[model samples]
Target chain A: MQKTASITIRRKFRVGNLVFHVLVIAFALFMIYPLLWMLTSSFKPGTEIFKSASFLPETWTLESYTYGWEGISGYSFGVFLGNSLFVVALVMVGNVFTCSLTAFAFAKIRFPLSSFWFAIMLGTLMLPFHARLIPQYIIYNDLGWVNTYIPLVLPKFFATEGFFVFMMTQYMRGLPREMDEASRIDGCGFFMHYWRIILPLTVPSIITTCIFSFIWTWNDFFSQMIYLSKIETYTVALALRQYVDAMGNSYWGALFAMSIVSLMPLLFIFIGFQRFLMDGVTMGSIKG
Target chain B: MNGKRREACAGYLFMTPWLLGLFGFTLIPMLISLYYSFTDFDLLTPETWIGISNYVKMFADKKFVGSLGVTFKFVFIGVPLQLAFALLLAVLFKKERRGIRLYRAAYYLPSLFGSSIAVAILWRRIFNKTGLVNQVLALLGIQGQNWIASPGTALNTLIVLQVWQFGASMVIFLASLKQIPTDYYEAATLDGAGKLRQFFSITLPLLTPMVFFNIVMQFINAFQSFTPAYIVSSGTGGPLNSTMFYSLYLYIKGFGEFQMGYASAMAWVLLLIIAAFTGLIFGTSKNWVHYD
Candidate 1:
């Protein structure tokens, strides 16, 4: 009797496990179906896209990609892609330099009102950007910085993004103070300590910052829309948005194809650096 | 003593860029915004200080009031639902299952591009009159509304888009869930506690802090959400203004119409609205949000 009961229990457990996997799989598919549909739809002929909801295309073609690459007016899709890359690259470099340098100060060196300044920095993380948006626009407009990458990439150089600063500070503080002291005892000053010792050790945080800065800057549209008006200077975001006006209902295939092309780089970075992204999420939560 | 002075000097020097940023970008701009809020001006006009007029004008503005209500509904409805989905999936994934890593990765993919223009474009097409949704409905012999064009469903579609990207919150929840001791579940099991009982009595209480964190962060983010709305609504927030989110309206008012001062006033109110809600959540969190 006992042996039979144990067998029954094992069978029940197996069924339960199967059910769990099925449910999880169904939900996961539901979550990702829209994206897959978009992808498959991009390859579909524009006319067939609205004919059926099936995510799979009956006949796939690369014609959309070729046509989409033709771009709007005189600007090719390559120009938009290049513009995005240039802006993203500069923004990432600026964030890495400004955020790390400022965080190092908050973490290592002593100064008057150091704690006060650090608290203020953390406070800025909670403050909404809208509070300063209008005035910042005015300032940028006054300086003739509107319609330039200066308004976008320049802020990163000043550590205007407080989250990165806070993240780096948390990371640097967690590092053993003895490392800094050891470097100092070896006749290294603040710059050398930060450059040769602290910076190398803060690689993980730097990577996290780079990933975030790249994604945010690449995906950014608000400032890009407000500042960039010229067709030549339009980023992928601006160009894609303009495509809606320029393409209207026609060329759905091209629109979808170009959209897919635009997302590829971000998706590539995400797949490659997913571990760092996950770590960054958790770290931010812990600090949150 | 000399070394201390030098260190302090070095620290200040390193902070120069950020200090300039704070004053030049954040702090001083905020002050200027506050001053701007009291005046009236368009792009071409010099600021004419009309005491409290800009603030008063918000009450008379139809779009301002409508957008406020839309935003509130979006935040209160979208955020909680997003958190629910996040928590549910997170709880399910808490156990060590086969292929768990791949599953989680798949689930997390949408949010990576959730706010991007590509998704926005996809979303716009997916809700069109002859779009994928309606086509699918037709296959089942059911009529589907033009989701983005109809006022009632337009906001809901936007809400769905927001809630669809719950992966970030889910990842956070899963992280916290992993940190919970297995012994609690074991102990509950010995007492004949069922899965549902254990979830409520043990898992939930332990998960509140992370829940609170996600809530605050997500709400703050949802309040500032502009990209998806701008893209999905085609920058008009139309279909009877159902998708007129506050930030979009602000952009239209300030930049689109050149009502910079009016936009400044609107921005301050948004700040207050955010601050008040955050404060309310924090104040009430002690009752429900438990932490170790």
Candidate 2:
């Protein structure tokens, strides 16, 4: 009797496990379907997108990709892609260097008014971008930096975007301060210690910051739309918007295709460094 | 000779980039906008000081009032609904089930493309008059409106789009849920508590902090929502200004119309509104946000 009851309990547990697995798989599929639709639709002809259809493309073609890449009203996506890449690269570099340095000071260095300054920095996070938009526009205009990538990349160098600084500061706070003390005992100066010890050890945080900055800068449309005026200077985002005009005849297939292509780099980076992203987000929550 | 002074100097030096950027890019611009709010400073030539005229005009502007209403509608409605969905999904996936990682990644993919121009374009197509939504409606022998082109439905579409990107909040809640000890639930069950009762008695109370955090974050993000309305409405805030969000309106004033001073006033007004809202939440958070 005891053996029979144990077998029944084990069977019930197996059933429960199977049910949970099935539910999880269904939810996962639901989440991924939109992305899969975007990818598959990119390969389909413009007319085929609307046809109520299966997941696989019946008549797959590369025309949309080709058109999306080469055909932006007398200025190919190559230029736009290059412009975006350059801007994103600069922004990433500036964000990592400046944000990490400032975060280090906030996290480690003890000085008079440090807490006050930190409060001020945190306060800036609450300041809405809309609050300073017009004035910043005027300043950029006066500085003759309008219609350029300077506005996009320069603020990053200044730690004006506070989210990254905050994240890095939080991460840096959790790191062992004993490491800093030990390095100091070895006659290491602040810069050397920061460069050789702290920065290297903060790889996960750095990756997190880099991925975020890259994606944010890459996907940034408002700032890009406001600043970049010339067609030659347009980011891929701006170019995509400009591709569709008032006549309602957008290159839907090509647009979707380009969308997938544009997302590829970010997706690749995200998948490659997903562990860092997950850890960073979790750490951010704990700090909050 | 002085180690303290050297460290102090080094700290300030390390902070210089951010400081300069903040002061030059953020602080100075903010101050200038405050000053400009009282002036008629068009970007063309010089600032013509006009005291409170811009503010008075803004008060009478119908579009400003309408956009404010639209923004409030979005924030008040979209935020709670999004949070509820996120929390539900987080709870559902909070267990150590097989393929949980895959589920998490899939849910998060929307956030990756959430703010992309491509998604916006896709949204327009999906909700257009002859779009997939309409086709689905046709299958049901029902008629569907042009979601993007219709003023009534445009903002709603954007709200749905916002809710669809609940992955970030879901992830946060999932992390927070994991931090809750399983023993509490087990104890509740041992005490003859039902699953629902256990959730309310233990899970809900413990999850308050994350809920509060997500609400504040979502509110701020929703208030500043510009890209969807901008892209979907083709940067015109069209279909009779149905989708003309506050930020988009501000953009039109500053960039499109070149009313620099007036736009500055609008911006300051928006800042105050957000500050007030955020302050109200923070004030109330003490009662509901359980830290420990």
lDDT of candidate 2 at residue A224, scale 0 to 100: 96
- List model 2 lDDT by residue over B1-62, tens digit each: 59999889888887888889888888888998999999986677798999999999998999
Structural similarity to truth (TM-score) of each candidate = 0.96, 0.94
lDDT of 2 at B101: 80
Error of 2 at B146 (Å): 1.4
Instruction: Encode model 2's per-residue lDDT on A32-150: one tens digit a residue.
Output: 66667778888888777877545667899998899888856588888988999999999989989999999888887876788888888887877889877877777788899999888
Q: A57-109 in candidate 1: lDDT tens per residue?
A: 89999888998999988789999999999999999998899989999999899
TM-score of chain B of each: 0.96, 0.96
As a whole number from 0 to 100, the lDDT of residue B209 in candidate 1 is: 88
Give me the runs in candidate 2 sitting further than 4 Å from their true place: A1-32, A51-56, A279-288
TM-score of chain A of 1: 0.93
A194 in model 2: Cα distance from truth in Å? Answer: 1.3
Clashes of each: 0, 1
Give the clashing pairs for model 2: A158-B18
> After superposing candidate 1, which stretches have Cα over 4 Å from the reference?
A1-11, A279-285
